[model samples]
Target: MSDPLVIAVDSSTSATKAVVVDKSGQVLSTGKADIDLLTPGMDMYEHDPVQWWESTETAISQACAALSDADRQRIKALCITHQRESFALVDEDGGALRPAILWLDSRAGDEIKEYGSDHIHELSGKPADTTPALYKIAWLKKHEPEVLTSAHKLVDVHAYLAHHLVGRWVSAVGSADTLNLLDIANVDYSDELLDIAGVTREQMAELAQSASIIDTIKKELTDSWGIPGDVVLVAGVGDGQAAGLGTSAIDEDVAYVNIG
Candidate 1:
């Protein structure tokens, strides 16, 4: 038997990148697929939502295809790090209800001004900023009430991809925190935060601790990709935190700055 391998996927604003690596973090192979960014109106950035999963599949399949049968069998798990704050409303079967709002979207200015305050900042541990999903969700509540009320779940990138990979509606705590809905201290969804966005706890993805194994990837997906059928899906953090780990910036003296 050879050393085990894993797939690390970064689903970002522009593309999804898949890299196969050994236990020592050596890059064995890589693949990428772009995600179309839609600018339907001034200050609005959106994605078709379905493209999130599609691009991921394309990228991962391409990466796995480069490996020999032995290398493929060595693959044991996969994890995803994605753009923070981007999210979509989906039905029970994971169908998108509308275009997903991206982190850079600025259409929620009015809602941010009206609802942004010290109390919210204290609870969420994030200032009333354009990057958080809370304001955008409030925008939807006011402008698209039916869509808000009808959604079965409001999911960030981690939850959305995790569901398709593992057949569970789950998100990593670190990934979901960017939505500005979690109580920072409790590290769980907050009622006041959900109420402001017209959502309920039941409508949120089940939370998993970051770096933990949430569930196994579906055997059908693994079989199709020619990887091990028992490949598990590991819960992951947002891109910002992931970068820190990648750069070995875990100490108090070192800091990682991403200009891009």
Candidate 2:
């Protein structure tokens, strides 16, 4: 029997990348596409969600196309790792309500202050900043009321991709935890937060375990992208989580930092 094939998807502020590997972690194929980050002024950064999606799709398709049929069929699972905190609002029809506010965007700094620095820090385990979803959502509602009112769901980078791949809106615990909408203690959605964001349970995606199988590749997506029918789609964790796993940083004291 051949080794099980694995694929890893990394979507971040700057780019989306996909890599195909065997059970032994030997890379077979890799592809990447960069998404342009727009900065209209100081403390304002954004990206077109449609472009991001297109880039991700192109990267994954290219990676799969680079592989031989037998290798593709052996694909056992696909994992994803995405940048934390960036968010996009989508309408009921799955169209983006507006451009995604990236993690680095700081136009919401004052809005974050309204939530109180200490309260946010205690609840989120991170200092309240422009990077947190809470502030971004608040900023959107205030500045772009029309867009916010029409939005049917607020999603992070990975959730958006998962929806496209699996035909369901699902979010990962790791990513959700960074959203400021989930309680850090219980790791579940916070009602107070949903109320603050003007969203309800029905407007949110279901949360899934980071390593659990979220869904198999849908037949239509597989057919369109020429992916094997047996490919498994694993609910990916945040980039930091995936790096910790990849580097065997399993202990609490283990530290891994990225600097660029």
Candidate 3:
């Protein structure tokens, strides 16, 4: 007779939050973990990739600790949403290659000038702004070419977390759209964009639709967190997309703004 429960995780720039919600749309529990934002130089922001994963696990654990045994058992899914336009590189083993470049990084100013064009803008729904991940990735090719070639996967936060959670290097299409690498109209990767970023489609996570199952949580995480091994891991949209969903502004005509 108990309401079904769902755990939602939001991994943003400064912090990660985990909220447990029931079928009736009320939040049953909430938890958060702070992350350090590194500003190595002017307009360059970075986050330790390891810290992202660690903070996510800690936040989810904190959230679940607030739930009762019965409530935890009733949980049906783990859903994740995150900041848009942030990205990192991972090895074949899912080990992080380096700190993640933040969406605001201006290190690729020159590359932006070169790659910025009407064709690219039309190909990707996003404009050629510093906010997109590709410009900074191009900067990596010019300055640290080895890093780009050495990387096994050019992933967003969702792909990294999904790998850890479900053993799949796949991400929600909606979340991957933030990378500026996908053809938003087609909801898939753009070959031209990949060439500009110095990566191949093989180096990206397999795409899954938002709200679908990427995979199930692995036994290791389930055991460590005291969650069921069979718990489903659902693909989640970008934070902006989630906001629209949360606000009941499902129509494109309706604008949802976050004052924060």
Candidate 4:
């Protein structure tokens, strides 16, 4: 008998990659699809939310097609590891209200400067920077209050993909950490931070720890990919944390140094 299979998807800024792996951690198949990134202004970058989901679907479809029936049937998990800080505001039905702002976007410089403080840095474990999604959310609130206020959920990339895959507005705790939304020391969302970003707890995804099984892939999506609908969707962290986890750095003593 063959080993159980798992499909891991990485939804990145430039592209989405899907890799099928066996229980032994050997990759059986791989697929990738490019994502279109738009820069409307010098410091503003965005990606169509639709393209994020489509790229994921296209990548998975291509990866699964490369597997044999036996290998495919053994699939047990679908996990997603994605970019950090990028976020979108979605309607109740998981539809995007506007293009998702990318992590690289710096249009919220003024907001960052205004809200940037040691207290915020201590609370979020992130200093006011161009990378945190909080600043971008503030920018949205200032320029498009109507749209921002009307959103059913303010979510990061992981939450968006998780909703589309499993029909739940949930995000991996580690993945949402860098959004400048979480009280990292407590591993939970801070009401003060949410208020600062002009978002509410009711408008945020429920948080789950990394690798926890959150939900199952939707039947429609599974049927399209030729995978069983019962396959569990596992929660995953952002690329940085995922890399640390991959390198077996799960504690303070064990560190993952990324030397360029």
Candidate 5:
């Protein structure tokens, strides 16, 4: 039997990249697709949420195209590492209600100042910074009340992509943690935080632990990729956490820095 293979994806702010790797972690093929950044106003950055899934599909298809039939059949799983704190509100069928808000968007500065405090920092383990999705969601609640109240779900990049991959709404704990809606100690969503964002638990994705197998990729996706066997989907973390893991920076004494 051939060695098992996995597809690893990094859906960053600028692009989506995919790599096919064997059990030994040797990358056999790779591909990439760019995402257009949308700026509608000062300090407002966004992306068409549809582009997220479309780019992912394109990148993965390109990567898997380089593999042989046997190699494709050997593929057993898929995992995603994505930009943290970016999010979108979607309807029940996963259609984006609007463009996804990017992490770098600073439009929520006012909300941050109003809501940032020791209590929030203690609950989220994230400083009172512009990066978390919490403040931006609050901004929406204040200014775009109709958009927030009518949306069926609010999801991070991981949950959005996972829905396209597996036909389910789920996100890894580490991935969702960057949203500042999680209770850091419990590694789960907090009611207090959700209430502050004007969303409910029903609006969140079902959480899964990082690195665990979540579910098999949709049959249509595998068929389109020319992969004959079931390819399980693995829960993933935010790109920052993935970077640490990629660099072997797990130990307390080690630190990883990205100059870029």
Candidate 6:
């Protein structure tokens, strides 16, 4: 019998990575790609979504290439952990609508204030800030109206990668919650927020649980990358949530803090 395999993809603010692990959580292979976050001005940081996609692809391909055919055949699932809130818009054809505004982009400070920070905190359990997609969307609409008008979907980083991997757009509940467009208590996008952001429901990806299987690896990609075509792609959670689970900090009363 073969050892069961799992692939983990971590897409964070500074880089993207992939790791192949056995059932025992021992890593067999790992790959990483650095991404440059561009700050063109004060309160504005951006990245090319196309570059992000390429980085993710490079990481996955490199990881898979390091495995033998027998090792690849044992792969059971591919799970992702990603940065939250940072997003890019795409047209019907999946092409980027514009450069993605990162989580640290504060160009939407006025929009966050307009949405009323107290009200946002009450609804989403977090204050309105540059870290939420709502503010970024507002920034795009105000300053890049052309791009906003062209966009058919508003997608976070994970959803974008999932779409490229499985050939379908999917959003995770935990990730969606970080968007500030979702009612955290209800775990769905808020109509009130749509009204506030002037976006329609159709603009968002369908939501699924963080652990749900979204799709299998598409044959072309699998063949090209020497990975099993039947590998399951699981819906990804936000990085913080995945870290909590990996570190066994899911229990209440425990808080994980990052100093840097």
Question: Scored by CA lDDT, what does every candidate get?
Answer: 0.94, 0.80, 0.87, 0.90, 0.94, 0.82
TM-score of 5: 0.98
The sequence of per-residue lDDT tens digits that candidate 2 reaches over residues 1-260 is 47887878898888899899887788999989999988887888888888767888888888989988877777777878888888888987678987888878888767877874687677667677766778788877788878877788888877888888887888888877777888778788888777776677777788998888888877776666566566777877888778888899889898887675
Lowest-sum lDDT 10-residue window in model 1: 226-235
Error of 6 at 182 (Å): 0.4
Clashes of each: 0, 0, 0, 0, 0, 0
Instruction: Superpose all Cα atoms of candidate 1 onto the true structure and report the RMSD in Å to 1 decimal.
Output: 1.1
Better candidate number, 5 or 6, judged by lDDT? 5
Task: Give the per-residue lDDT digits (tens) of candidate 1, residues 136-182.
Answer: 99999999999989999999999999989988899999999999999
Tell how far residue 247 is off in model 1, in angstroms: 1.8
User: What are the runs in model 4 whose C-alpha is more than 4 Å off?
Assistant: 249-260
Against the hidden reference, what TM-scores do the models get? 0.97, 0.93, 0.96, 0.95, 0.98, 0.95
Against the hidden true structure, what lDDT does model 2 obtain?
Answer: 0.80
RMSD of each: 1.1, 1.7, 1.3, 1.6, 0.9, 1.5
Q: Return whichever of 2 and 6 wins on TM-score.
A: 6
Which tens-of-lDDT digit does each residue in 174-259 have in candidate 6? Answer: 87777788888888888988767667789888898988988887788777778654888888788888888888887798878755
Query: Which model is ahead, 1 or 2, in terms of TM-score?
Result: 1
Candidate 4, residue 88: Cα displacement in angstroms equals: 0.6
- The better candidate by lDDT, 1 or 6, is 1
Better of 1 and 5 by TM-score: 5
Candidate 5 lDDT over 72-157, as tens digits, reads 99999999999999999999999999899999999999998999999999999988888999999999999998999889899999
| lDDT score, candidate 6, position 3 | 72
